[model samples]
Target: MLYVKIHQLSERKFKITQIAKELKISRPTVYKYLGMTYEEVKQLLEDPHRKARKLDPYRDWIIAWLEEYPHLSAAQIRDWLLERYPDMEVGESTVRSYVRELREIYQIEKKNIVRQYEAVPEQPMGKQLQVDWGETKQKTINKKEVKLYFIAFVLAHSRLKYMEWQNRPFTTRDAIRCHENAFQYYGGRTEEIVYDQDHLITVSENAGQLLLTTEFQSYVNERKFKIHLCRKADPESKGMIENVVKYIKGNFADSRVFSNIDDWNKRALQWLERTGNYHVHQTTKKRPAEVFLVEKQHLKPVSSLLSFESNHEQSITRNVGKDNTVRFKSNRYSVPLGTYNSATDNQVYIKIKTGKRQTLEIRKQLEGEIIAEHLISLEKGKLIQNRNHTRDRSKGIEEYKEHLISRFKDQEQGRTYLNEICLKYARYRRDQLAIIHRVIQEDPGWIDEALTKCLKEKLYSANDFRDMVQYFKNLKVAPVRNKMNDSKGPKHAKGMIVTTRSLDAYTSILGGAAQ
Candidate 1:
């Protein structure tokens, strides 16, 4: 090819060294075909007079094996021949030499030679982000070896990267949370997010259409971002993120004394800000954070994005307000007072089933012992209290008020608080009474203080009373149903029933006594 290119120079007698220098080819090769035209060179190359080989007789059989197992090395084939037929022995050199010819004949060299692929076409700003996960084993954290699973997000155009590390495998919820965190880190999100055949998000692919896991679909639908799956078995499609994963392992995680997951993530974030984003990216030759400022404008801000939990299917545990309501669809949906009014267990878990239909039903999960359901609301943030749901609490309300007023009705401020709760809670007045009853059970000392604060703030729920108790206990404000305190966290349960055992039964067993 070099000789051909040099010979094509019109009217220029290019020196052999000049041809060699221009084409980066050896001088001897340039001189070998210096005066030859392209046609003469082609003819010379086509003149196939090859030397005979000792293993030529077995060449056909060797080619068959090569066809069956393309990965078989020359030495393996030579050993197989000697072992299979003791009568016929072939030297290693002869076998290797014959294999070279076979490779040329069968074009098998393409398999062994490292291929150079064209770089992916550059996407427009904010067009695409590639995501992938990497595993790091034998990582020592806090004096123990652990396996680390980390995900990487790379902005195709800017080469900006977001790396999040976890000590455990990512569930669907974890992946969604990481994506949200990544978008927040970058100040926005790309138009399309690219992914490998990740099992958490992908179900399968048919021809070219990508089939995503239902949870992931809801996640993307909520954010209004497009999802692009890399072609099956095509690592090159998401090569950028693959490179980023390697980069993170080598640069950030390797040779470092790993701490716990949270500490590792915190340090990783600092490392990104200090070095990864600020320093020059090798390919782009631009600081990612600096270029990100320009690219950020084109990306969609998270504030404008309304996604899954807001618009799509959501299952969460919410404390019912004091008005016989458990908030859902950003509206006050009615629950029976027995559920929200329980003195010992006022918490209820909600699961929204069969989404995207008119007249969706919020059926009670029987295992949860839920006793109420509501029609799905299209409008958001409205008070959708059912009048009849509160009516059942009316008789219970008057009875509880008479009992409470007889007890604290003497205290002037206490009387005012009870009166205000009765007016604000109405049919749910007994629900507020349950809160007072729980305060009396858990900490009678704090009941007056908690109720005084609750009444002043117009907070009329058991959770509010607990929040006040926690606040007074710790002298620091915390959530009412914080996961640390509650047996279950914010995530609602599905297909699982929660059962409790009394301490008194365990005490009886410990004392070796019959109940």
Candidate 2:
């Protein structure tokens, strides 16, 4: 073929350089091939005995595997070789070259089996809506890649789409909030909503019963919408929204340099107006925005938005660092000292107030009480701390120590042990005092014993003191607890039900022994 192309190009009066450029080959090679006849070229190039390749010994195996699994790639073949023969030494490039040669020589063409999808009949307006999630990595203003997750909602009938993006993964609360936004954007809600069995909403599916997350279940009940959770590995059931997700990623998100999330969302809305909902859909052949006008009338009126534990307050959980700070949007905000408990998890709830200038209210996990609040910062890597939160909560350590010592029988010994703990763990004095104070509250009887043992053994830590207290408490004999009296129990139950004249009967039976 090379000899034919070279001679044919020469007969057509084409220059050697032009032939080499057209064929993407070097000029010297073109000239060398042009010098040989077809028969001579075949003899030299198709020589039976060529140099053996590193992968030549496995050529038959590669050919067999390729013939069996036509879609197998060269990298997969290299992995299989390494897996099968641990001692084999081969490079990726060598395997790729060998695989290509084998495929070409043996005519083993790779086949890609595209999944067959049959179009389902479109539902009536507001009858159904499909929901799906998508994610993409895009460049920021600084050219750094940032991953953005998004949820897409599309009307099954009109294909009108709505989507929201965030820098973090969607939690159940986030998903519920997004649903409210979608309902407001569409001006109404659908009778039933379809989902992809995502954990953000559905917790589990058992025997055809779908169990949704607590928050999501409440949202669904409030919205009064039926949920249709698609089976696992079956995205085709909700293909409408799946395609919408793809459309958003490819057209709206692709190549768009993201700045702040607010700006990105603003741009996304603009794109939806000009392109996404405005442009003609390939399958429907009509603009989604136009179809939405007619479908909007049939949609059920959207009820008031859900209160996610607070009115318009978006809540998310974050881990408090050892330094008593929680990170949000690359900036750290201070919580009060003692917020981070290593024994338990350090997760705290961050409630974002909805307004023009957002304020973050960091709350304790269990009580949901606001521990700290700060105006949200737009800048990155900043510490937006409150001066009050940074106050040394351990400033009252002297008074707290004295109060705890007063509870001990030997106040001087208590003071000495606490002072030693402070000297040894200056940074952890507050934690030590807290543990000792809790131990004192539980049982001050063991304090003298534990303090004496700790002082004698030179165990200066609060943990050792607590452990010693526990040991001493366990050694003390437990008080005898009397059984409950039925007369003092609930009024509904019978109390002992003893017959009358019991004393008289006993006296008569023991008449001889009465004395």
Q: TM-score per candidate, in order?
A: 0.39, 0.45
After TM-score superposition, what is the CA distance of residue 371 in candidate 1 from its true location, in Å?
A: 22
Q: Write the per-residue lDDT of candidate 1 for residues 1-515, one digit (tens) a residue.
A: 34446566423776667766655455665566665777887786566675556786777888887876676667557645654565675665777777865764454532443534347787899999999988886447456778889989889888888888887778666788889888888888889999887777875676877766556677877788988888877877887887788667755665456767788888787667755676577778898888877888999888745445553345444555666677666787776543453333234456665646533233333233445656677889887655645543545665766665554423676667777767777775765676565455555545556666877788766567666875676664321322355667553333335677887888887986545
The lDDT values for all models are 0.67, 0.77
lDDT of 2 by residue, 204-275 (tens): 787779877555676777788998988888777877887788778755675557898888777677667755
Pairs of residues at least 3 apart in sequence or in different chains that clash in candidate 1: 222-307
Give me the candidate number with maximum lDDT: 2
Model 2 lDDT on a 0 to 1 scale: 0.77
